[model samples]
Target: MIDDAGSTLTAELSAYHPLWHLKRINWLEGFGASVPEDEPITTRVFLIDTGVHVGHPYLSKAIDAQLAIDFSALPFGLRYVDGINKPIEFDPEILDHLPLSANDKATISQLMQRASGKLCKAPLETALHTAFPSHGTACAGLIGARMPGFFTDPLPSLTDGKPALAVPYWGVDPLSTIIPVSTSLNPTPGQLILALVYALQNQADVIHLPRGISVAWMSDNGEYDNPGLSLKTDQDEAEWEALEALLFAISRTVPIVCAAGNSGENSLAYPANLSLEDKGENGIISVGALSSAGFRSSYSNYGPGLTVVAPSDDATVFNRYQIRINELGRRYRLHDYAGYVGAGLPRVDFSREAILSTDIPGQNGYTGYSPLGYDEDDDTFAHANDPLQGAFTLFGGTSAASSIVAGVVALMTRRAKMKGQILSGPQLKQILRATARGTPADTKADDINGDKASLELLFGSGLVDAGKAVGKIGA
Candidate 1:
């Protein structure tokens, strides 16, 4: 559907399937020389997650390193903090399962000694010390991996030589900038709130959180929203109001894109579900995942308050994530690259189910998993782990989906900015809903059902159509 002079193509992409999403959104069609230089400055996306690896070639190219902040060090004793609900202390038992070699473990302890006197401590000896691996960077990559040549334009329609045809260039907004805030290795409610303020103060147009904040009582009836909620009071109704207020403030200015969680239930994840009413009018996007084949992912959360769907996987192709056969003849999902598992992470053969992006050089896998050797693709692992310099690894979940939407928002905002218009957060949400097409209705568990609008509960306004959204700007 290249309606313009071969500049853009509209194809339904597999979420963050930059190659896919870009074509579906017809991204390049709007790329005009008339855009001002400061458009990117006004359209920054702040990803509040694990913090980016800041080293992947594609991400490194796309992100603003100057805007990156590592809050993992700010919230003391949070090296292994995952969430307030899943509280993690620096447990001695974790010592036994650390994904490091003996020498690397010793090296971490020694590095700690050297960092003790420093103003801020070292990030981590490796990904081993972290509760999660590649969380922030993977999200960042999804938001801005224009990507390396392979990912940006994966499937190119060829010429039978009748006439020279052009396949539109594909990828997220290459011009957009990302401001990464690494809340913690494990983020608490306090850390999340702080991250929100920091991102807004720094002038982010979009705020993307990859995970769901577990709420004790947010089933569409709870009315507590304060912006001053603390770690100790995270579960308190009083504290939740504070959290909601913070979300409300951020959404008023910057569109807050959040994952709808992966429980596969009909429940909605908050902040994404942070509306006084259910249609999510407070500038929150409760993104659900669609497999590449245009069906609701079995693992994606649904029901009331959900905003839109994006492709993380395709049902017909994989029923989970959209898999791609790479140039190396290796089968993998897009952006979810193959790479090595460094120290301080749980070891498992992660090649089959993760999104690959920039990593802290020589990072580890997830925590508590046994160390693994190559099961099938030795060369892919070898290349990924070579001196562990590539700084690439895999990650997944609604976090990736949320960031993908954030990327689209960035594109929309940037496009609008160039046209002498500014899209407020609420307006952004409205545009997405108005422009979106219908997606597969929920039929997974057979009984998980509800209705928030005219459409089926699970799919929201359907899959987010980025091309249509941009087209609606100023209209």
Candidate 2:
């Protein structure tokens, strides 16, 4: 019902590959869910965004790259500086939507009609910003293919042999050994509360944000005290009171996942509105989106300070939803628009689409580096392209759903170091809210808040079942 013209809906869609267009020894014999090489599954994960392509080839040995962490020392120009920059397009009438393969629906409807005419734009280059491995090099090749020693170069090499899917930018800096600190722009709750007080005096476990604030720094006046106003007006309470003192000074000790925003409404997203009441810092979780049939996500952004939920993979209706509950079971409803497609609202690209991960390089041609003035390493600068391959890519928001839930919380800290019981940050968020995945059934209740408080506003402790959060961190 939606093909009025645009070349008959760009002749039915698909055709837009730039994450290096494919070459990493033939893209790891098909990406995503496949891990068995004697059961690998490493885990490091830092991805502060606007940087990471730490030598692609699916994730060059799992990227540590000799401490190269760059919290904006320069690069990160845009391409979504790391999360929710806007895309949406697909309302060609929704007969159950999900189609786009004709080269990703004529390259995402010619990049949303060239971003609605201004020649296309909005925070795009993913994989948490840049260094090049596009899509954070396929999400660090899905966490070095399921978390064992979390690669950066343990075995990956096969041009004429076999093991393809690449990785190798060993410079290093997965949070500069744990947060030394640097700066350029895009961060100012007094530098995210001085990098959460240098990552809680250094024993850092997680902080990742994949971009989720700047809609012109929110608060179009919702009562924030209007200094200028545009985000809608209320001045958004002085940036939510300096993000509630940087979320009670870094959830008391690391743990932060932000990104339940791509302008998806139901309001209350900033630092998950500093978790409304438990003002005692429980260690912040706040994810949203869910789609691969898990439900919820009509652009995610509900209330009661949302706690969890995942998979955000909508990619223009490609599917992935999450946070279930229906058939009189209850709990559903989350919309900005339901039927009539076009105005059927919901944004964060309907909870991100075609996900995948890891990919950086929005700029990387360094050599004559310059922190403030300039130094050496010339050859007209501009390096970053070694054995990493196109790195990896695929897009959508909540900034790749907060680095796929911080790479499943670094695979639950490598399954709590194979079980010795040392899990921190409020005991890994009380074992991810006592093993989430509940739903009572509200079947998208009029899209969200027309009843049942839109099921706790919008899936607070409902979805996020990454194999039951990796089987409750492997029991």
Candidate 3:
């Protein structure tokens, strides 16, 4: 079932793309059913994560570069001022300009100091080496990537065995504007709060936090365990309380969608877990990942706070060489690989599925440029060049799932705006929950609790159905 390299058995490349998920959520049908209009209302979804590549072909049309902000430059920690050491503070003029309470400002200053200490001990830049540099680009593409116009000829399907030409990679709400807010690779609570405030100020219709924060303590077994919401320090409490207040305020006007986390634990990460608290009509919408099989993904965190599930990758193995060759043959028409023989081709394990979205262009990001020497069998080195190889990649996790939900929310916002109505965050959540479909039969039912309660714990309301949500909003 698995090879020594951990690569899964190979299957057709179509199985790893997002079209299957798109169809399952009824994306096309829902938008197709909407009333025809000369001009559809444009909505904005603020994405706070690693910076996006604004120049990517699929994302260039949707990104609003003028409104984008790089918050990674925010200073944190102590600094000597006039030979006197003091906590680094925001300029008095700038502090006065903000609409925050005095207490919140003080807490922010304290957080900045704490974040600085953490950075000093272990810089986040080192961690970025193994991390996805194009994380923000991937998330943004899921929300608003427009279809590229390069493919004049029909390409092989990227979803299933259907004979019809596969649709090119596109996002749920291609017309929606993306407000990119760049933060540190691992953002601290203060940075996240500041980003939220910025998004609010910019009039973002929906906010997508495709990352999570966790507060953990070392156990007796010398392992760290998360203590959700039960913060140990006064500073931690103050920061979370402030964040909760801001989220509540924002939710009154626009929906905030957050990832449930990638750790396969029974409890959710912080902020996302905050959704469990009773916020009475308005709260953060926590999203979990669903495998192509319609079951909870093995790596997706679960809990009562989870608001809904969305399709994502669920493979245990990845054969990079095979994936690249398949893409080149199918999409780029570079099919002269001597290494790719009939039945001898490598197989991927666990039915290897992934979400196909935009990536950072060039060899810097995932799906690196050209797969020429990666495989040993290909002697035809001269014919192995693919110019657009790095433009797209297969990405997954609750991050991708949350982006899908955010895009759906954007579509709903546009639909409501077209009908001359403004739906509150709570109203949008209500519509999504009411219209969600049930979990698949293959979903694990081992929870001691009854089926309905257990399903809610694992999948929140259920799988997010875009068509139903949009139709409800329009009605």
Q: Which candidate ranks first by lDDT, i.e. highest? A: 3
Question: How far is 435's C-alpha from truth in model 2 (Å)?
Answer: 17
Ranking by TM-score: 3, 1, 2
| Per-residue error (Å), model 3, residue 32 | 2.8
**Which is better, 2 or 3, measured by lDDT?**
3
Best TM-score among the predictions, by candidate number? 3
lDDT of every predicted structure (CA atoms): 0.54, 0.42, 0.65
lDDT score, candidate 2? 0.42
Candidate 2, residues 122-151: lDDT per residue as tens digits? 223353333332434443343333222324
Model 1 lDDT, full chain set: 0.54
Error of 1 at 243 (Å): 1.5
Sliding window of 10 residues with minimal summed lDDT for model 3: 1-10
304-398 in candidate 1: lDDT tens per residue? 77888776742112222232223233334333444421323322111123334444443343212223223242243422323344344444567
The model with the greater TM-score, 2 or 3, is: 3
Number of backbone-clashing residue pairs for each candidate, in the order shown:
30, 115, 8
Tens digits of lDDT, candidate 3, 100-200 = 57787677555544432111111234222223447888899899887665222443334455523233567878778997776766554566776776676
Find the number of clashing residue pairs for candidate 3: 8
TM-score of candidate 3 on Cα atoms, chains taken together: 0.70
lDDT of 1 at 402: 74
Error of 3 at 290 (Å): 0.6
Q: What are the TM-scores, per candidate, against the unseen true structure?
A: 0.64, 0.28, 0.70
